[model samples]
Target: MIVQTLPGRRAFIRENTRLQAPPHTPELSLHLADEVTPIWRLTEEALEEIGLPPPFWAFAWAGGQALARYVLDHPDIVAGRRVVDFATGSGIVAIAAMKAGARRVLATDIDVFCEAAVGLNAEANAVAVDFTDQNLLNAPPPQADVLLAGDICYERPMAEAVMAWLRRGREAGARVLIGDPGRTYFPKDGLEKLAEYQVPTTRELEDLAVKRTSVWTLP
Candidate 1:
């Protein structure tokens, strides 16, 4: 519907969300929608009616929070490396990679709104994170020393496609890392668990106040 003008999107983000630190990664702040925010009450159908994308960029999902925490705690994983953050909702992982000393980070998402969301978030954290609305799965994975993805295994088809693409990136020499909260579609094999956490979340978003999430690497 062409409703996502950059200025409007930025204003929407600022007006509907607040800059807050994620529970698991308190060192970084992001513009996130909380229970008190108007956006928090919006359903997918309502958002679609208003020509807005699902508000994935408006919250710090458990997977992204855990992955960001892991990256910040173990900076060596991304330090001095070129990184790509796939499905970078709110750009939490990308910002973490930059804070962890990555040489550069390209945050990619199909949702056009994320460009605005990530820009605001990077500014909040005082970090530089490049963002694109490109669907990275369509091309050869960009050259990267580290590739990060989080909370992307919700739907079956998307999970399969993303995992396949991540595997290709791993085969091409990029170290691929994923953070998940045991979604039904998340693969049950062929990954190395690096860390696990009882990530604090909101029941309104995840139907639970705490989620057991984990960070995994594609070896």
Candidate 2:
């Protein structure tokens, strides 16, 4: 069943799928559901409406949907855990973790703008999330119990670095979970698939080559 929205709820905003991206460029537009929304264009607008941020690098990739579906389907994974959304772009996974009952949620990103976005999105969802401008490339936070990442392994060097960090986190007994939508450099070994979901991508915002995506979980 589709998740139902609460009436006059200032908690979460839903993005309509029928909205079109702008012409002549790869930048897509979104509609915000909040009154003091921060989206500058249609792409940002849509994500603001959905309590998310416009795609940081590529709009319409829909990484948030993949993570959100996972949370809605399996709240048990995040229930009562201290979860960290590493490389949180628009705070999608972090928000989902909060919705799933994580004891505390921290959304970390290298991008400074993501901090503002996370704060705004968290306020929009009426959930508390610690948004920080820390980079996980050096190391995972020492206090993280569950490390969650989505759509982070697209580039080669970055993917390698992230995988190494994840391996270390796993060795340290932390439950490391990754939500990848078939990105180019996603690791293919030693990972048990937890779930999968079909997510939408936009040719107008990104390349037509990666129009649609499938979300996968690494155990």
Best by TM-score: 1
For candidate 1, the 10 contiguous residues with the lowest summed lDDT are 40-49
The digit string of per-residue lDDT tens for model 1 on 65-156 reads 99999999999999999999999989999999999999999999987678999998998888999988888888889999999999999899
TM-score of model 2 vs. true structure: 0.70
**Alpha-carbon deviation at 188 in model 1, angstroms:** 2.4
lDDT of 2 by residue, 1-219 (tens): 121222211122233222233121112232222222233354443234444444462232455556656775678878998888878765767877887789998888864345655665566566888877767667555577788877777789988898888777777777877777677798768787766655555544445534344444445
- What overall lDDT goes with each candidate model? 0.89, 0.60
lDDT of 1 at 157: 98
Instruction: Kindly give the stretch of ten consecutive residues in candidate 2 with the minimal lDDT sum.
Output: 1-10
Clash total of candidate 2 = 12
What are the per-model numbers of colliding residue pairs? 0, 12
Alpha-carbon runs more than 4 Å astray in model 1: 1-3, 40-53
Residue ranges of candidate 2 with Cα displaced over 4 Å: 1-60, 206-219
